[model samples]
Target: MQPFWNFPATAGGTINSINNAGIETFRGNELDSLTREICQNSLDAVKDEEQPVIVEFKQFQISRNQFPQRDELVNAFNKCESTWKSKNTKIEQFVEQAKYILKNDQIPFLRISDFNTKGLEGARTGELGTPWSSLVREAGSSNKGDSSGGSFGIGKSAPFANSKLRTLFYSSYDITDYQSHIGVANIMSFEERPGFNTLGTGYFTDSHNSTAISNLLNLDPSFQRDETGTDIYVTAFEPKENWVEAIRNSVIYNFFITIWQDKLVVKIEDETISHENIGTLISKLDDDKEEYCQVKAYFKLLTSEEGIQVPYPAKRYKKIGEFKEGEATLYIMKGEDLNRRVLMTRKAGMRLFEQNRISGSISFTGILIIHGTHMNQVFKKMENPAHTEWEPNRYEEAPSEAKKAFSDLRKFIRETVQQQFQAETTETMDAFGVSDFLPDTTQVAGEGDEKKESLTMKIKSIAHKKKEKPKKKVKKKQQKENFEDTLEEVGITPEGDQAGHSNDDRNEGEGLGGGTGNQQGEQGPADEGTGGAKEGKGEKEKNKPIDVDTRYICLEKDSGLYRLNIKPEKKFEKGKLEFKVSGEQSDYILPVITVTSNDIEITSIDKNVVRFVNLTGKKPKNIQVQVDYEQYCVLEVDLYEI
Candidate 1:
C-alpha cells in the first residue's frame, strides 16, 4: 500500500454513479460559493485574536507534467470511460472533460493560501476530529467547534467543484508544527481490471491510511507554505476573467462585518481588503452588479456614530446552547432611503441574513450583532452550511429551544424598533411579518370601558372649541401647523395620555383637532395654518392652508409586485404616482412593470411612474404595482383633482 492515488475496490459491492452531490452543491455556485466557503473555513481557524487572519487568492499556471501521479489519474479516467461506454451517460461526458485537461501542454491552477491563522490542525495525530481529517476524510460531519463559521464539512468540495478535472490538493502546516499535503479526486467510479470495481473517491497520500504526504508537495514554483498556514491548489482550474473581482465581491458580501472589525483580511490578486480600506473598497463596488447590494449601506451603519446602539439582554430570551445572561447589541440608523432591513450577525462577524420581520414606517437600516459566546453558539447551530440564513429547525439538540430562542430574538428586536425608531403609527407598517404584533382595532371595547382612540387609528379632523372674540389676540401663541406629510409625522402618545385627554389645544397628537390657543405637546406643538399664525376672524380664516396627510401602506403581491393601500384626504379627486425605486445615492430607478387598480382606470407612464385619471373622494384605493426589483419600495406619489 504505497502512497499513491488509491480508490479502494468497492468491497461493499455497491454500484456507484458519477454524481457527487457535495461537489455539485458547490459546482453551480462558481467562485461565489468557493470564496464564501474557503474564507469561512479560514476565518474559523483564526490562531490569534489580536491580528486578522489573511486569505489570499491567486491563479498560477504550470507544466502538465508537474501534476504528481498524473498518469494514474488519467488511467483511472480511461477505466471509468470503458466501464460506462455505449450508453453515453454522464460518466462518458465527465471522462471526456477529464481527458481534455491532460491533452493541454500547460495546466491552469488556482492556489489559495491563508496566513495569520491556525492552519489545518492535527495532521499527524491520525485523529477523527482533526481539521485535516474533516476536510479530506470526513464528508457529512464537521470538526468545527461551537463558535466556528461552518457546521457541515461539505464545503471541502468547493475547490474540487472549481477544477475542470474535478481534482484538488490540500497542504497545511498547523500551529502544532505538523505539516502534511494530500490530493483528492472526485471522479466517476471506475474499473481497475476486467471485473474489479472501485469507489468513486480516491486520495493521493504517502501511506495506506489516506493521510497526506508529509512535507513533499510544491505543485507550483510560486506556492510555498513557509508560515503556519494552509495552501490549496485547485488543479486543472479554468476560471472566468473577472474571477478576482468576483471573489472579492463575495468576501465583502458575506464577511463585511468580520473585515470591518479587523478580525479577517482578504487579498484577491493585487487588492488587499483590511479594516482601514473597507470603506474605500465598498465605495467602488457597483451596487447594481453585486449580490450584496446593501453592503455599502450596511458598512456605513456599522461605522457611523449617529445610530442608536441598544444593549439587549439575552437572559430574557429562552435558553440557546448554554444560555448565557450576556447581552447583544442592536444598531438602529435612520435615513430617508435605507429601505428598512436589519442584518443579523453572530460574534464571528458573518452576517446570517436580513431580519425584515420587524415592522415600522420609518426608513432605517440596522445591524443586530450577537457577541455573547452562548448566543453565538446558538446562532451557529442554527445556520446552514453557507451561513446565509439561520433556521432554528436546523438546531438538532432541542427543537423547542431553537424556536423559543428565535421567537425571543424577534420579540426583543421588534419591541425595541417599535418603541424607538417608529415615528407615527404602525398603520403604514411597510415591513412584512409584524402584522401579528399589532393590536386588532376591529375588536370592540369591553362593556365598562369607553372606546377611546387606538394609537393605530387614523386621526380625523376635530372641531376646534369656538373662542369668544379670541380675546383680541391676547399674547400670540406658538405651535406647529398641521404637520404636512413627511417621514416624521408624530410621536406615539403614552397610553395614559389617551385617557382623559382633551380635544382642545392640549391635544398632543395634533389629530386634526382644531387649536384655538397655544398648547404644548411632548413631541412639540400642534398648531393652525401657515407657521402657527392665529386664525383671523371673518373671511381671513378662509385663507388657511388645507393640511393634507398622504400616507400609503405597501403589501407584497408576489416577488416584484407591491400593492399600495392609500386614502385620499377627501379634498383631492384624482392623482398620479411617481414610483422611484429605493437605491444608493437616491438613484430612484425602479423598473415598474404594470400598475393597475381593480376599480380605478390606471396606466403606466414610464419605467418609474403611473397615472390614474379617476378617483372617488376619501375612498381607500388599492393599486397593484409590479416592479422589477425585489420588495417594498419608497415611492413618490402625486395626487391631483380630475
Candidate 2:
C-alpha cells in the first residue's frame, strides 16, 4: 500500500510521527473544527456553475466483513510491535484498542459527501496544482486560486482526529476523466520490528501498485453513481450520540453566510437545512432566544439592501504607483442580545475574524464585505493557515506589490471599522441620554448670574401686577444684589443658582401668573392696603426655601426604552413641593410622545409632576415610571429635591 508518512529514520529512532500534529490547531469543540474545515474544502472544490454546492452528512454501521481490505489491515496490526522500542504506553494501548475494535462485527462510521463540484483530480505526483496528489500525499500543501475559500490543506486531519481508530477513507470521482479513485489512511504510533518496521501511517491499497484499490465499486455502491464529487468515511467515529445535532449547529454557525448567499446547501439525514428554513433549525438547535433573534436579524440585513457603503483605495494595475477606488457594504446592529463582533468576508463568501471581540458592551454585530478585484486579493493574502484571522505580518513578509497593497487594505479596514464602532457607540449613547448622566461643571459667571437676577425680577413684577394697584419699580442693580445676597445666605452661591435651578423656576418665570394676567381697575384705601400686603407676600413666595438634593440616576443602556427611577433623599408633606424634572422632550424636537398621560397635571406643557399612587396601602421608598418617546430620541428625567 502507498504510505505517505514514509520518512526515513536511523536505528532506535522514530520512522515518522503519525500523531495528530495539525489537529491541535483547532481550539474549540471537535465538531466546530470538522464543520468549518470540511465545508471550506468543499467550497474550494466548486466548479464554475450557477448551482450551489450540496453537502450531506450521514451515519451508518458496518460489519468487519463489509470493511474493504479488512484482512490486510488486520494482518498489518498483528505484525506491528505492540509497544515501540522506546516503550511508549499510548502506542501500545492504541494498537490493542484498534485490534479489539476491528475484531468486532459492528463498527460506526460517519460519511460526509459533497455533490455538484469538481472532484480531486490530477496527476499523482503531489504537484502544486494536482488535487489528487495534494489530498493524499501532502500535509499542508495548497494551490487554491485567489478566490478559493481554503488555502491550508492541513484541515484534512480534523476528521481523523474525530475517529477513535484514527482512520478515514477518501473516495472521489474525477469529472475530467470520468474515473473513480479510493484510498484509506490509518494513523498509528511509532513501532519497530524485524524486517516489517515502517511508519505508523499507511494506505489501504495494493502493495505492488500504490494507486490501486481492491474492488472499489463493491465497497460502496454509491461510488458508481456517475457523479463528480467526493465522499469521506470516518471509521470508529467517537462520541456517536448526538453527533448529528452538533454537526448541524456547527455548520449553521460558521457557514450561514454561505447559505445566505445561495452558494451552499447542507443536509443531515432526511432533513434539508438552508437559509430559507433556518428559523426551524435554530429552534431545533436549542439556541438562546436572544441569539436566535440576533441571527434572524443578521440574515435579514444581509439579504436586504439596508447597509452603509464604505469606500477605500485599492491598487489598480501592475504599475509601481497607482490606485483605484473600491467599496464595501457595512451593516451594524446595536443591542445586548447580539454578539459583539465584526465579521470580515470576501467575494468567495468565506468569513474571517470569527474570534475577535470588539471593545464595547454595546454589542455591535455586523459584517463588512470588501468588494473589487484588488481589495479581495489583498484580504485573501492576509489569511493564515487556520483561516480564522488576517495577520499583519503578511505585509512585512510578502513581496513589494502585495506588501503595499495588503498594508493599505489592512489599515483601511482597521480605520473604517474603528470609525464605524465609535460612531455607533456615540449614537447609542445619545439615544440613551448617556451624556446627561455626567456632572454639569460649567461655571456660572457674568451672563448667567445676570440672567438669574433678571428672571427673579420679572417674576416679582408679574406677581405685583396681579394685585389691584401697580407697585413702585425697584432698581435693577439693587434687585440683582439683593437676589445674589439672598442666594448666598441660603447656602446657595449665585453660580449655584445658575447651575442647579430647577425647571419649576424657569417655567414659572416664563409663564408669569400661571397664564392668568391681572385686570386693570381702581380700588379704595382698604383694598389698596390689602393689595400692598399681598404683593409683599408674593415677593416672599417667589424666593421660597427650596431644599435641593440631587442624585444621579442610572438607566439600562442595553435597550432603546428607559424607565425613569426616582430616589428622594428627604421625606415630604402631602402639599410640599415633591420634585421638578428637567430634560423632558420639547415640542420642537419632533415630540416623541404620541399619546400623553391621562393626568393633565403631570403631562402639562409648562411644568409636570410625576405623582405616585399607592395601590397596596403602603408607601414605596422609590418609584419607577415609563416614558414613551420616539425610537431615535433620548429621554432623561432629572428629579430635583424639593
Q: Pick the candidate with the highest lDDT.
A: 1
TM-scores for all candidates? 0.69, 0.60
Which pairs of residues collide in model 1? Answer: 480-527
Q: Candidate 2 lDDT, tens digit per residue, 1-642?
A: 442323122365455444457755653467778887888888878875588888888777888988866766766566454435246666567667888888999887878888888877763332455886777666687777666766677787788777777777777766664444455554543334454445566665544334534222334434344577778888887664487777777776677778877888888888787768765665454445554454565665565564445666545546334445654555655544555555677766665664232333234566767666555555666678777777645644445666566455545544554566443323333357866976555657755543342223334443335545455332222222233244355453211221232221222111101110011122111111011112333432111222322222213233322222222333443211222222343111111121122221232221122322222221222332333332333232322211
Cα misplacement distance, residue 206 of candidate 1 (Å)? 2.1
For every candidate in turn, the CA RMSD to the true structure comes to 16.4, 18.2
lDDT tens per residue, model 1, 163-216: 888888888888888788888888867778767888788888877677777773
Q: For model 2, how big is the CA root-mean-square deviation?
A: 18.2
> Clashing residue pairs, candidate 2?
1-207
- Angstrom error of the Cα, residue 320, model 1: value is 4.0
Give per-residue lDDT, candidate 2, residue 198: 57
What are the lDDT scores of the predictions, listed in order? 0.69, 0.53
Q: Which portions of model 2 show Cα errors greater than 4 Å? A: 1-14, 26-28, 83-86, 123-129, 189-196, 207-209, 212-224, 283-294, 309-328, 333-340, 354-364, 371-374, 399-642
Alpha-carbon error at 111 in model 1, in Å? 0.6
